[model samples]
Target: IHSDRGSHYRWPGWLDRINGSGLIRSMSRKGCSSDNAACEGFFGRVKNEMYYGRNWAGTSLEDFMCFLDRYIRWYNEKRIKISLGAMSPVKYREHLGVTT
Candidate 1:
């Protein structure tokens, strides 16, 4: 997990969660927002596009997890980006003859 040095991110509960989950915490250097700009932008898009204003009152954790996973796959493989000539990253790479 990558984050800026915000107070909440440094909180005991947050730290415990990350440590308990065995996920390595990566923090950006001091005063360098651009270091994680692309990641931040992707997270912002995810939150806005899928999470904002949505009610998950009766959704089970497993179902929500599945939804999130599918959404990310779709975002990376199907959703087109205007900056990539209106192609998804996968398609743009293929167009450039970059095999993956």
Candidate 2:
């Protein structure tokens, strides 16, 4: 997972786990936000399209939890995108004949 040097990601033991899994660790430089532009772009799109004008902002945690669950399902299964060749990511995998 890509992230800032925030509390959730700066754990000392995390290096061992990442190395054990044989996954290369990638990170931005200190105070260099452009090094992580992809993450920022996605976050910005989600916020603008799904969060900026929502009245649900004032909802209770339980309501927000329900909304999140439903939203994720819709995003993964029903959402289509031009970038994914006009298909949902799941559908794109299907086109490649990939099996879960």
Candidate 3:
């Protein structure tokens, strides 16, 4: 997981949990916003598009996970981006003959 160099992320408890899960911890250098800009931007878009001001009360953890998964899929597959010439990322890739 990537994050800023925060004390919470450096805590032994958090370190142990991340290690146990076999996920590598990645932290941006102090004062380096560029390193985190892409991730931060994606999360900002996610909150704006699906999270902010939404009523999520009574939603189970599993249900919320499913909803998030679906949203990500739709975002990647169907949502149009003017930056991508009015195409979804997947479509843009295909348009450029990118098989992967």
Whose TM-score is greatest here?
A: 3
Q: List per-prediction Cα lDDT, in the order shown.
A: 0.92, 0.78, 0.91
Question: Which candidate leads in lDDT?
Answer: 1
- The residue pairs that clash in candidate 2, if any, are none
Candidate 3 residues 1-100, lDDT tens each? 9878888888999999999999998888888899899889988999998988889999999999998999999987889999999999889999999958
- TM-score per candidate: 0.77, 0.60, 0.90
lDDT of 2 by residue, 2-99 (tens): 66766656576987787788877666678899878877886686677677888885799998878777776777787999998999988999998994
* Candidate 2 CA-lDDT value: 0.78
In model 1, where do residues sit more than 4 Å from their true spots? Answer: 8-23
Ranking by lDDT: 1, 3, 2
Per-residue lDDT of 34 in model 2: 86
- Clash count, one per candidate: 0, 0, 0
lDDT of 1 by residue, 43-84 (tens): 999999998889989999999999999999999888989999
> Model 3 compared with the native: what TM-score?
0.90
Residue 14 error, candidate 1, Å: 5.4
